[model samples]
Target: MKKLVFIFALSSFALTACSKPENKPVQESAQTAPQESAQTAESTAASQPLAAGDTAETSLDWAGEYKGVFPCADCEGIKMELELKSDKTYELTEEYLGKGAGKEFKSKGTFSFDTKNPSIITLDKAAENRKFFIGENFAEARDMETGEAIDSQLNYKLTKEAN
Candidate 1:
C-alpha cells in the first residue's frame, strides 16, 4: 500500500512539473472586457436616470393637490382630491358623484413615504391601509390591504392640479 501511494504521488508531481504556460494569441473575449464594462455602465446610467439615487420622495415637486375620478361600482364615480403637504401631512376629500352633489367625505391624516421603496406612501390611518404610488406629478391609488398596484384599467391615476 505504501509503495502504491509513493508511485501515485511521484507520477502526479512529474505530470504537474512538466506543464508550461501557453504562448498563444489572446482571445477576442479578453480584448472586449473593457468595452463590455463600458456598455454595462452606459446602460445602467440610461435606465436609471430618473431613479438613480433619486426617489419620488426626494426628487419630485410632490406637494400639491391631485384630483381624479375613480370608478365606483355602486355609484357614478368617486371624485377624489388629495393634497400632500410639505410637512408630511395630507388632506383627502372624496365625493360619490351619483349619490349626492354636495355630500363630500373629508379626512385629514399624516402620511409617510416608504423608505425601502421610495415611491409608495401610506396614509396614517388605523382603520384602513390607504396607500398611493407617487409618480412624477401624479399619484395612483393602490390596493386596500396590501398596498399593491390596482390591476384595473379604470384610471386610478390622480393628476396634480396647479396650485
Candidate 2:
C-alpha cells in the first residue's frame, strides 16, 4: 500500500510539472495578437506624418554649382565658387585680390538660404560675427566677402553653372 501511494504521488507531480495550464495558450495568443496589432497600427500612423511632410517640391531645386565674379578696385578680381545642396545649404569659397599686384587672399564659409526666399542667403563663421541679408539675384550680394561696406563696384553676382 505504501509503495502504491508513493508511485501515485510521483506520477501526479510529474504530470502537473509537464502539463501547461488550460488558460496559458489562450493568454499567450491574446497578448501576442494585441501587441502585433498595436505595432501595425503605430507604424501605419507614423508613415502618414512623413508622407504629409513630403510635397512635390520638398527638396530645394537650387542644388548645383555656381560661380560669380565681381570686379574690385582694391583687389585683382573677386572670384567666388558656391556649391549648393538639396537641403538649402551651401559652401562658399572666395578669393580676394590685393589692389596693386593681384595678390590673392582666400576664405571659406558655410551658408544657408531661407526656404521662403531662396535668394536670401545667410553666412556664418566660427568667429561669431555673422551678417544676414536679402538679395534678388546672386549678383546682388554686396556683403559676400567682408561684412564691412566696400566700394559699390565690388558687388558680386552668382551664376548657375550650365549642366
Candidate 3:
C-alpha cells in the first residue's frame, strides 16, 4: 500500500511537470476567446441596473419564483418561496422548519420599487415585511423597517427557479 501511494504521487508530479504552458492565456486563445466574450457580454447585461416603471424584466428575467431556506434564530431554517410577477404582484409563502414545521404563512401583495432606489422592491403596506434587493438572477432579502441585509450563515438571497 505504501509503495502504491508513493508511485501514484510520483506519477502525478511527473505528469504535471511534463505539461507545457500555453503561449497565450486561456481567455485570449482563439478556441476560448469567443466563449469568454459571450460570458463577458452576459455579465455586462446582468450588471445593468433596471429603472422604476420600466416594465422590463432584469437581464436574467426577475419575473419568476425564488426559493431559499434562510437562517433562523430558533428554528433550523425558514423555507421561503417568493413569486414576483410582471404585473407588480407578489406571493410569499414561508414555513419555519423544525419547531414550527406544519405552520405555513402566506402573504400576497402588490410590490413597488423603492422611490429612491429602483432595484429595491417593497411589499405592500399590509405585509409590513422585509424588502428585497432585486438583481439579475436573485432577490436578496433585507430587514423591513431598517432596510439592512439580514445577517446569516446561510445564503440570504432567494435563487430563481426555472419555469
Candidate 4:
C-alpha cells in the first residue's frame, strides 16, 4: 500500500510538470502586437513625400484633330473640333444642329494641370468656361455653350488613320 501511494504521487507530479504554464511568453508577445503594428504604420507614413524636382513636365502632346460629339438627352447633337497648339494652348470650334438653336461657336483657351489623383485641367477661354479631367492616358472636358451645359468624356486609343 505504501508503494502504491508513492507511485500515485509520482504520476501526479509528472502530469503537473508536463502541462503548459498558465502564463506563456508566446501569449505575452501577442499582447505587443498593436505596438508593432503602430510602429510599422508610422514608418510607412514617414517615407512618402514629394521631393524637390518632382514637378511633372507639361507640354502639348495633344496636337491632333480630335472629333467629339455630345449625346445628351434633352439637346441637339453637337460636333467639336479641338486643335491643340505647340505652346500648350488650344483652339476650339463647335457646331450644334438639331433642336434648340443652330449656331457655330469658336473659342481659344490655355490649359494647366493639378497633379493629384486624376489630375485637373483648367481652361481659360474667351466665350466659355471649361474644365478637363486629365489622366495618364486620356483626358475629358466639360464646357458651357450658349447658357447650356455640355459634358463630354472621351477615352482615346491612338491609331494612325490613313491620310
**Which candidate comes out best when scored by lDDT?**
1
Segments in model 3 whose C-alpha atoms lie over 4 Å from true places: 1-60, 151-154
What TM-score, over all chains together, does every model reach? 0.68, 0.41, 0.61, 0.46
**Candidate that would win on TM-score:** 1
Q: How many pairs in model 4 have backbone atoms within 3 A of each other, for residues 3 or more apart or on separate chains, i.e. clashes? A: 0
Tell me the lDDT of candidate 1.
0.84
| Runs in model 2 lying further than 4 Å from the true structure | 1-60, 97-110, 115-118, 126-139, 142-155
lDDT of 4 at 58: 45
Error of 4 at 140 (Å): 1.2
* Candidate 3 structure quality by residue, lDDT tens digits, 8-127: 999998877666444345435887878889999889879986444463244437789999998888998899999999998999999999997888889998988776666778989656
Worst 10 residues of 4 by lDDT: 154-163
How far is 40's C-alpha from truth in model 4 (Å)? 11
- Give the Cα error of residue 14 in candidate 4, in Å: 37
What are the lDDT figures for the candidates, one per model? 0.84, 0.57, 0.81, 0.56
| Residue 151 displacement (Å), model 2 | 9.4
CA lDDT, candidate 1, residue 94: 92
Candidate 4: pairs in clash: none
